[model samples]
Target: MSAPVVKGWCPGAHRPMMSGDGLVVRVRPRMARLTAEQVLGLCDAAQRHGNGRLDLTNRANLQLRGVSEQTHRQLLDDLANLDLLDPEPGLESRRNILVQPFYEHGDQTCRLTEILLDRLADLPELPAKFGFAIDTGSNRVLSENSADIRLETGMSGGLILRADGSQTGVCVSEERAIDAALGMARWFARHSSPELRRMRNLVRHTSLPGHWTGKPPGPLATRSEPGFTPKGPLVGAAFGQILALALDDLIRKSGARALRITPWRQILLEGGHSTPAPGFVTRPDDPLLTADACSGAPICPQAQAETQMIARQMAGRIGGSLHVSGCTKGCARQTAASVTLVGRNGRFDLVKRGRAGDEPAMRGLTPEDLLTLTDLT
Candidate 1:
């Protein structure tokens, strides 16, 4: 059966509305991978066809917000030309798959990931947030906080696919390794309600399949540290536009085509290493990494200031992750970072929370004064 057509708020659509069932519209520009030319094209397209702004999602994906209905078709067509669209719409959001930067470089893990995408694309009910991680046996992969399903190399030339906190399947071949993951995803889709959008959610309520014995698998030699850094030095992009352009260029220049869009609004470009050109920022200590801002004010109709601009100004100055929202909607990151700046009128309010959704202390402050609030710093 063909996948279900997603209903509700289509992202990048011109309409300012909300939909419980959101649609993930895929775009492909020549630079999905990072190359200089591709990066420029992506930036130009985003500026012209989108809200003249771009957002960097925690998953490291570049989202062009405020896309009008007229441009939506063009965006999809363009992305398709770049081979960015998943064959099946059902798999669009569920394609939350990741691979270790090291293992992804011309290895079996990368090949297996493609197969997994193909398999999940055919499965209609996978949750919109269903995710997979294939470790390239590198230290710089995302933590378990980032993936619902993970594949790590095991001792004796086998692979182990873990679900939530337990090992569910083990295989000797990469093909079988990915197949084991798809089996679990399809099972979750069959048993879960549409409201349970993530694998963790499903795991919270349901027991494992009968085939799942809950037995611990054999010890694997290649275990990834929870938050191991990837092979290269960490780089941060001020916003999604910079990231999109940098990624496009990275893909073009370096044969290192595998890209991992992280949830931290950071892009992980694997393979060849290159420095950012003039007018672009790539340092970890850059202010952009320290701050996150939403599309605010004039652009969002729901914002108070151009949060991105404010954030860019305060990036490196702030010590922890400071999220700047145009309004309470908070489209920046899912989990609250160290500090949050919610904009209202020309002023801002400060909130402190350990995680995304925690109640914050809504005290007001000005941008200039915010620089002095040293608790987070």
Candidate 2:
């Protein structure tokens, strides 16, 4: 059978997407922190009903792969029992809020996140992928992330509600932040057609409020590193894929107080405690960190080539960032990479300094042929 195609919206726990795998069910943990029991429960559920592995998404969500249609109902029930499922099916798509993972309890980010969650119902119905970034950290941490709405710290250290792709933002008090955010959403909803789903798209055609102006926030302060940092212990998952059994074991051994997922192919273990786990990237310069890969071939029927295997082989040898995509869809990394290898008909097409969909510099190169090219240096 061919792989099922997914368009427009993202997959959720209640609404799954079909892939080469039987079914892909996503889990969005409220606040990005999962208890040890919840973590273990998720692993057990994935192993029992789906593929034994879990995919950590760029949105900090978890995806269970290879779930059979027959077992999907049971799996949803299991997830609900674990307090992992959204109460209302509609709420699942609307609760696309991402909180900074390093936030402390009762911090501004946490407070704002709660407010946003509570106000989700008041907002106009948005596209499933439309999201908010509650990035009120000490420094902007999610500037590079995907979000239509952003709650960021302004120059005055006061909160600002900024629409993505807009340099300006409206200053708002902590109390009114959610209201302003919702107002912006309503504005966008009123003006947007189906094609204009995101704030960036709406801004192209419609004018924003005059009040939405302030100094733009800076870029991400620093990229998170593996192992223990003051914020937490960062553990890397090669190609952003982790086996449920292995992760369960790691959690058992690490003794972390809590766990938070990151978009950067790593997991942050809160509390000062963490033990090095096998198959995890511990060092900063681990070559795998520079490579973005997707599950290809047998796992994804759309894939004509194996992606992770090729990425693993190219890790230490290749310099700079690389993306090994199963096809032109470029699911692994949305942005253009320094070098991209797009698979076609069991061979690779090289796209230099562009995304997978970009015109290829060369085509039909096997992994061995690709490695032998002197131009790679």
> Highest TM-score, which number?
2
Return the top candidate by lDDT.
Answer: 2
Q: By summed lDDT, which 10 consecutive residues of candidate 2 come out lowest?
A: 1-10
Task: Write the residue-wise lDDT of candidate 2 on 26-93 in tens digits.
Answer: 99999988888899999999999998889999999899999999999999999999999987999888
- How does each model score on lDDT? 0.55, 0.86
Clashes of each: 34, 0
* Candidate 1 positional error at 104, Å: 4.4
Tens-digit per-residue lDDT, 226-306, candidate 1: 122444423445654453444555555644445545445555555546654433445544656556676566655556656
TM-score of 1: 0.71
* TM-score of every candidate relative to the true structure: 0.71, 0.95
